[model samples]
Target chain A: MKAAIFEHAGKMVVEDVAKPQIQAPDDVLIKVIRTCVCGSDLWSYKEGDHKQAHSMNDGHEALGIIEEVGEGITDLKVGDFVIAPFTHGCGQCAGCKDGFDGTCDNHPAPTNWGGGYQAQYIRFHYANWALIKVPGKPEDYSEEMMKSLLTLADVMATGYHAAFCARVKKGDKVVVIGDGAVGQSAVIAAKMMGASRIVLMSRHEDRQKLALESGATDIVEERGEEGIAKVREILGGPADAALECVGKQAAFEQAVGVLRSGGRLGYVGVPHEDNLNLWELFSHNIQVAGGSASVTTHVKNVLLDAVLKGEINPGRVFTQTYSLDEIDQAYKDMADRKTIKSYVIVD
Target chain B: MKAAIFEHAGKMVVEDVAKPQIQAPDDVLIKVIRTCVCGSDLWSYKEGDHKQAHSMNDGHEALGIIEEVGEGITDLKVGDFVIAPFTHGCGQCAGCKDGFDGTCDNHPAPTNWGGGYQAQYIRFHYANWALIKVPGKPEDYSEEMMKSLLTLADVMATGYHAAFCARVKKGDKVVVIGDGAVGQSAVIAAKMMGASRIVLMSRHEDRQKLALESGATDIVEERGEEGIAKVREILGGPADAALECVGKQAAFEQAVGVLRSGGRLGYVGVPHEDNLNLWELFSHNIQVAGGSASVTTHVKNVLLDAVLKGEINPGRVFTQTYSLDEIDQAYKDMADRKTIKSYVIVD
Candidate 1:
């Protein structure tokens, strides 16, 4: 089998690797069909040790067709098309039952059993909880529709989680920071939740256009104080809520700064800083919520319907696609900010 | 005139000072009838410079009788009795109108014109915005009732702000960290909001008793992991919400640790730490809210009615009282943790 292995900082390679097999009773062996490079993958690509002599898994988002199912599986069968979220959960845990599947008590942390999504084959444990089956046959959907459906696994779900956790309601003036794919998804999520207006902070011309298409009513090209100033000037006041998709300190500060007093700030970014000043947030009466998204079967189902109905086209976030052999170039393009997100078609 | 001055760390003195007079068009000169020491004031007393030559104002929670009013004053008369919150806000500002009085754009920060509530006479700026009328003549209420009413200015209001911001609904299992006056006030606030069970973390017998009297149904004296263990053991699981009344890092961590997934943590204590771990908070989907309480005219009015109706007795938090001459003793006793809170009867 061919798999994408993270060789070291600024380096990735597609090489022959052992194929995955079902180990757990509920495990499902899937033939990888499509996977994409996430912004978070850039963190390890930029700083991981180059001389560590270790090859690690390369992706967390992917979709595939089930090739085999373990004995315990009941709801799903062979050849089912399913999407795998960035992280998996056990379906029966209290956390999973309550919709926080990301923090499932049964599978508390990410394990290294399955190499990565950018592989030809992978074994997924807790298949019943981790895999969301697509409703129709693969032949029923166009390539564009399939791409949009794939986003329900992580990016779109993450974006929706931000709006959901912040409780974005109708008539809310929302500000989404970051021009990344997830940020674009948040703009759509805010709109889906009936936010009256969405201010997207994106400096790039390409992302700004996508943001507007994703339901952003306004775009602020400035960053930091200048960006916040532009947003406030456009809105004539602070936004009722802000979704921080960039985990940098300055981005977090800007997100909080542009919010009205008592406004909610929902963040889905993997934080890069050790701490955020609680004093600043405290003085303004801002509430901070949202962590790693708990995208369960329910959230995926809703988003899948929206994608199928063409209400939201999150697939636009994937601006570039590459074959498994071009994996290194895909990583380089995403890391270099030359693309919003890169898709790796592995089938 | 006489006032309590913060001379240095661990030093306070009541000395002769210039009497206050109206300086602004909206200022009002008031004779401070009652004042109480706040937990926040202890920070300056314990760590302030020892060799600093200048003395500073020391109290922010007080009630008084209006002695004079500026030309702009209309709704309040010279003989009206009122209580001043620790901070003031312009009633016309968007922040204030939204119930975030602490972050009022017109008056964004706390000012020093009043020279602290320990003074015999203090000039309050933004008189209409800073002061809340007691709704009756001074002679009509007992000293105890006045003391209780004073808590509406800060402690009780702060406690209520925590529960309010956390959105404590009926039947919630609430855990309050810290047994200080504000924490005790939170216990009362949670109960008033109809929480099914209130768990108070207090080690001292006196504070525990006060917490129980204030509506705490259970007490967990253990601190840190032990404390969390006991709480979970008692509740059969993590609490639905937690009120962090203590500003220490461990206290905040404990509050977040004891909450169930998706639980809310409302904090009113002035944070002593620079940052809270976003990683831990993100994983659990816990929402953190409550800052320097924006207890506006609306919140105060509602709490005042509750206090007046004998629905809650926040005044009991004032465990001891002292005259202006004994101001130093009051500071020493509070710094030494001998009293939950101290009151100064300036009249």
Candidate 2:
């Protein structure tokens, strides 16, 4: 099997690796059908988080056909088309029961790509709980677009989950920070959740337009204080909730600034810097929270079902796509913002 | 009118001040019926808050009667018994619409008392929105207990709101930090909200028992690290929602430590300390929030009505009472933790 592996700091390679085996009775092996790069992958990619311990396998958003199922894998069978939920999680756990599988103690994670953005074959534990059968769609549906839906395995779910965490409701005024796939998807989720007033803060006009089309009622190009003040002015007060999708410290502060006192804030951005005033949050009574997207916990099968039903068109998010052999270039393209997202055809 | 005015840090005296008059068209002159001390009052009394420029009239909660009403005040009239909702909010404002009136710009405050703890009278502005009529209660309910129930004006409402903000649901496990009146009340409120698992952390066995009786299924007589471990041991994992009622760096961290990854936290205790690790909170995805309780929004009236209707008995919170002349002794009693709450008889 050829897999994308982290070889050294700031370097990655698609190398031939030993095929993964189903070690757990509830595990199954899936032949990679499609995979996509993620922002979370890029986080440690440039700085080498797990590089010291072992080769880090790169991608988390993936889909494939089950090639074999271990003895205890009853819900699925060989040749079942499926979307591998971003995290390997037991369906039952305190965190999973609360719809937060990313924090589940029973979830198994890869020693390295953990079957994420890999090629050929990989083993998945808790297969019955972790893999969702990809629902059938119209014959005209694009396979490339369906592959893009793989982002829902993580990014899209994250954005949707972030919006849900923000408690976006009917006729709510919401602000989404960041223009990445997560932020864009938040615009969609917030709309779907019935937010009448949606605002996006994006410097990119193209992304801004996309956000508007995705149900963002307004856009603010300003950054920092100016950006926040603009949001307030536009809304006549701070928004009901601010979804901080970009995890930078400044964006966090800005999200805090543009919230009405007692408003909720759901953050999905991984912070590049950590200095923030707790007093500000305290005085404002803002609920601040962010971490890894509990995609599996929230909507593992539902999002794919939505994709199959065509209620969501995630394929548009993939501004670019590549063959499995061009996976390295896909990462660079996503990193450089040359592509909003890139799909890798593994089959 | 004579008010207990701030002469300096630790120096407050009953001084002659002009009685407040109804200025706003929707105003009422309320001869203060009852007032109690709150911890924030100590800040002003000690001259801790930097913004204390005025001769600070301390106190933030009180109940009074409508002695007079502005010409346009149709909802209130002479001799109408009411609890002054400290937040003088114009019910029409956006902040008011969101159920947060304390931040309302047009909020008229206690010009007569500055806040709640004081002597004589207060002019309630926005009387329509700033006061609620206290319904008749059983003749058996003692005046002493009634004073404690009046705490619904702030502290009690605050405790319940903390749980409410966390969206605490029936059968949810709750962990409450802080054994003060607010924490104790949170146990009661969580019980009323149908929480099946309530854990209270307090070293005082008496408070622990009160916690257990107040609906805490378990009690952890430890603070900080040991306290969290004990809670985890008690519940297998962390709580679904943790209410932080003791505001301090350590208390906040302890609150964070006891939550399952997606746990909601409502912090009502005002923290004197500013140091809190933003990274820890963000990484854990613990929702952190606090502000002056919007007690006037819904809680005070609801709790009061409940008590009056015999739906609940919230008066046991009081442990001692003293005549107005014994104010100094009342402070000492509460400060020494000799009482769960101390009341000063004014009439």
User: Which is the leading candidate under TM-score?
Assistant: 1
The estimated TM-scores of all candidates read 0.93, 0.91
Q: Scored by CA lDDT, what does every candidate get?
A: 0.82, 0.72
Model 2, span A18-135: residue lDDT tens? 8888887988988877788777677766676555524746677777788889998888988887777666657687766677665554544321124345566777777787677765
Give per-residue CA lDDT, model 1, range A229-296, as digits (tens). Answer: 99999998888899999888888999998987678899988788758898888877888987777766
Report per-candidate DockQ: 0.53, 0.42
What lDDT is reached at residue B35 by model 1?
87
Writing each residue's lDDT as its tens digit, candidate 2 over B52-74 gives 54473566566666788898887
Residue A341's lDDT within candidate 1 is 92
C-alpha RMSD of candidate 2: 3.4
Scoring only the A-chain of each prediction against the true A-chain gives TM-scores of 0.95, 0.91
State the TM-score for model 1: 0.93
Model 1 chain A poorest 10 in a row by lDDT: A106-115
